[model samples]
Target: MQTQRNRRGYIQHFINCKHLWLNELKKLAHDLKNPYLLKENVPEYPRPEFHVSHLKHDTERGALCWIRTDGGFKDPHRGFRDPHKWSLVWWSLAVGPEEIKAAETRLLEKTYPNQTKEQAVKQQSFLWRFATSPAFSEKSRYGSYRFTFPLQDVLSAYSQQFCFGAPPIMRVFRTCLFKKKVQYSVLVHSPANRELFSEFPLLPGNDPNAVCAYRDGRFIWRSEAMCETHRY
Candidate 1:
């Protein structure tokens, strides 16, 4: 499809401009804390994805990159089940939430008949509640909220957020996804580079062991478990 080609072109552009973004990429790789997370000399184009956040009451722009893997395991799934396993990196910029809110708001205004400020706010509230509620939480399901943010709008927001604005070159140190209940992860810094960031406070936004999960319209992010109990 033309859209796929255009996105691929974006990746090519990223490769062409690697000099401008490589440091940022290294920063992200360092934050992973998993030395084996990235295979050597493997840089893939990052694809933008849309993520909805009930906590922020807005949608967000995030990215996914498929890279080669190095880790191995006994179980096929436990190991790098797919080529994109260990090298798979998903990240959202720290500034993504705010920008996405602005973009979504702008989109809502242009797509439908103009509404008074009060009406618009009320509708947004309804959409959030409807989308997050148990009955209609699934994003693929049809719903009125779907009209508020279409694929076109999401892609437009992605362009404005990344292409026109600063790209999410830095990895959010600690990222979380929410499922039914909010799950939090223990704070951890990579021993690999602890000396470099030793003075930094350990927080979800900057912790390197963090992994992202998505379930029931929620994202739970957690970092390395220092102990056996913490693993549970």
Candidate 2:
């Protein structure tokens, strides 16, 4: 009962914040469209197939490494030659809400201590959805960045934000699927605005210092030019 009540409280926060579709969601939250008390059964742990360790971090990890951004905007859902890549990597499991809260605490105080309080709140909000939602896609598919950060944390706090809307923006953090061992950073529902597709520019863009021309047959970036190249 308390969990159900808490979920309602969380949903209500959206209402107070004037979320665009809160009216439809508020009705659904109250059992107007579905049973408000219904819960979905979830496995205690993910199956072997879902293990993130098996993911390919040893090789390329499917990145256009020369481009400063993660693999390009290759989400096939956007149609051919989209050129816009996602900045987020979210993993999901059916953990209890309490576990989610503990994860939030552990991540903020220990994992991402450098972020400001405001940035930390945004990270926690994204983590909440990552732990509870069952919508994460497999990490290796559709082009994603892996092993881009140290084991302790994901992306930096000062990461940029892109918005299709006028001013409001959501910052995306880089999370790898593997570190010393498997981290299981599954891809969850990214906060994307389709209308922003053509407008919002994704990718860190190509720095002339770090271009990878396919020499002969294989893709390669000249390492000898390291002194010349400042960033990736």
- Predicted structure with the largest lDDT when compared to the true one: 1
State the lDDT at 179 in candidate 2.
10
TM values, all candidates: 0.20, 0.21
RMSD (CA, angstroms), candidate 1: 20.1
Clashing pairs in 1: 176-220, 176-221, 177-219, 177-220, 177-221, 178-218, 178-219, 178-220
Each candidate's lDDT (Cα)? 0.30, 0.28
Q: Which ten contiguous residues of candidate 1 have the minimum total lDDT?
A: 11-20
- Estimate, for each residue in 22-77, the C-alpha lDDT of model 1 and write its tens digit: 23334545443434324464333211222334321112222101111322112224
Error of 1 at 99 (Å): 7.3
Positional deviation of 154 in candidate 1, in angstroms? 21
